[model samples]
Target: MRLLRVELSRFFSRRAVAMLLLAAALLTALVAGTTIWGTRPVDAAEQARAEARVQAITSSPEYKRDLANCQESPEDLFGPGADAADCRRLLAPSTADVVGRVPLALADEVDDSGIAVIVIVTVLMIVAGTTFAGADWASGSMSNQMLFEPRRQRVWWAKAGAALVGTGVAAAVLIAAFWVALYLVADARGIGTGAAVQTDIRWMVARGVSLAALAGFGGYALTMLLRHTVGTLAVLFVYAAGGEALISLLPVERSGQYSPAENVFAWIRDGGRVFDSSIDCPVSSAGCDQTFQLTLLHGGAYLAVLVLLVTVVSAVLFQRRDIP
Candidate 1:
């Protein structure tokens, strides 16, 4: 109990945590306000204007020419002509097709911009968790802690548990606040209580929480193994940024499933494409050809195994290593 309190105090005492929490709150507010309050509700006037614009563009000679070129291209159909046809076919779909495919209500409810803020917050929280355990050892605080509690393993476990719990609480509070704020804004905007909004918000929040928890546990494990803040942070940044980008660019499709970050993203997307505007598979593609498919259960299992392995390793190290 004493160890848990001490760990919590140390975590909250850091200025970085406070600043991160504040920034997350502010960004959440901005996203909710802009998405729910700023945009006008879609009505007959808007629909008519959109229809008229679509008609005007599709009726244009350029659009007709491109469509004809695509139809005539052998690339889309057969040989050398197929290449030219394929190029022409890359043009945007007809406005009518786009409209037919779009879910205007879902589009209105979704704040795609919120995704950036959520990712940033998750990364920051992971950093905080990674440093929480290893920083004590690096700074010689572990010596004092061990002196007070002779069971080094216990002390390490307590610290890990405390960091996990603290981070989880902070994440939950921020998300809950954001949810309420968004709901209020949505109500004010007269968006109406619809199944789509309800479903999307529920899924987003649930997945966001799971992602944060996974990040927290993973960060803790990495820091425990590395034991140096700079090294751990560097590795985390590489994995979070460069590693994922490289994985995405790989020519081989199956290679992606093995990449940790890609799996995490797949988990977040819940088997769907990450963005509505982007198609996971190209036009005429039969199905999603992801290198890896991650279910929530799979992600949970991976995280659990990682957390258990790191905790065991760290405990052993704590028992065997000399206090600095």
Candidate 2:
């Protein structure tokens, strides 16, 4: 209990930690505000003005001729018999197609807000976990901690457990707070309420918290093994930014199975856009179409393997190494 309280006090005393929490809150508000305002439905007057402008273009004689010519050869961009003037005909908005394409949820708004929250929460958790563990070793605090505890493995587990629980609680609170703010903003903007929308919001919050926990654990493990803040941060930054970007550039087919990035990206689904996948295929590939159902299973398995390997290796290293 004494050790736990001491750790908690030290964690909260850091200015950087406080700043990160504040930043997450501010970012959540900003993203939610933008999403709600930007995607609000146009008023009838605004729609009418747009319609008038479209009518002016489509009612022209050139537009009529163009429509007639297009009817004869719909796919051809230009040909010997093509009427150049008619080719510029303004298209009438097809109600059928518009209605058919209407998404079940407001994707732009949800994604804009949801993705920002996820990223901020995840990054903060990772940074906190890494620095908390690594700082002890870097500053020679671990020697004292271990000396006090005597049981090296217990000391290690205590730190890891505290980090996991603390970060997880912080993530949950932030995510829930963000979700409530978003819902209120969305309601104010008169976005239609539905069970589906509520479900999506819940799912987003849940996933954000889960991902944050995963990132925190992963960072903690890395810090334990590396025993240096600089090294841990370097490796994490490389994996999170450079590694993912490089993997994205590879041929779609080759990347799906081999890229670690793909393994982590399979949990987000806002409306029709699926954010995360467990399948080992490029997101844009035909393979995704065929293997969509298998994504969650594959992704879970992969993440489990990675977490197990990293945790075991880090534990072994920490147990064997002398504190500097």
Candidate 3:
């Protein structure tokens, strides 16, 4: 407990970690601000201008000619069972379509801006974890710290615990603040979110927090194993980018199932679909289908296995390997 407390202090005290956390917070705020600004309620003047534009378009001679043509043979324009009313309704552009300033919708944001913020935070946390661990090795402080606490495993775990806990708490706070700010804006604008949508948002936040924390933990473990910041980052980059491409070359069916990005998004979104072109269709090209459903369980399990393998190997190696 004492060692963990000390390591936790070190984790927070690091300059890189502090900057990364600040960056995450700034990014969250930026995303929230952008979403709110982009989706601000359409003003009266804007609405009137949009209505005028629509009226102008509908009143044009070209529009009249097209409408008349469509009314003559609605089946040619909109397939069978269409009429003059259908032409009038479908041909005219609405004010909303012209204005294009949609009101803030929390449910839609969950799938769009919410995922973006989560991804940003997760990437920053990964860097935070890597730098925190890498600093000790780079400065040759790990050897000195071991002298005070000779048990290597205890020291390793204390550092790991600090990295995990600190990153997890920071992620939770940032992600929650993001949603809370947006929710308040939505409330002030009189845009109500249903109980079901709120529930979904909460669950998504929970999953996002977990994924970010684990990503940080994985970064720390990988750095510990490699003992160099750039080496760990390079490995992660290759695995993230090259691994997906390599998997595609394999003859395995549903090769996208092995992609880290796919599983990560699936875990964050609760579930997702993957399309693999490598899947050999049994019949003609017309009969080919490549899309496959990826469940939350599969994503969770895949991520857990990856983190577990890296952590176990890192811990085992740190126990026996010489630290410089």
In order of appearance, the predictions have TM-scores of 0.69, 0.74, 0.97
Candidate 2 residue lDDT tens string, 46-95: 66666676677578887777677676775576656655354554245433
Go through the candidates in order and give each one's C-alpha lDDT: 0.65, 0.68, 0.93
- Which 10 successive residues of model 2 have the least lDDT summed? 95-104
Sort the candidates on TM-score, descending order: 3, 2, 1
What's the C-alpha lDDT at position 49 in model 1? 70
User: By lDDT, highest first, what's the ranking?
Assistant: 3, 2, 1
User: Where does candidate 1 stray beyond 4 Å?
Assistant: 37-114, 195-200, 245-253, 273-293
Please list the residue runs of candidate 2 whose C-alpha ends up more than 4 Å from where it truly belongs after superposition. Answer: 43-52, 59-65, 71-90, 93-112, 240-255, 269-294
Q: Candidate 1 has what TM-score?
A: 0.69
Model 3: clashing residue pairs? none
Alpha carbon deviation, residue 275, candidate 1 (Å): 13
Residue by residue across 217-313, what tens digits does model 3's lDDT show? 9999999999999899999999999998898898878888888999999999999778888777776579567789999999999999999999999
* Comparing 1 and 2 on TM-score, the stronger one: 2
lDDT: which is higher, 1 or 3? 3
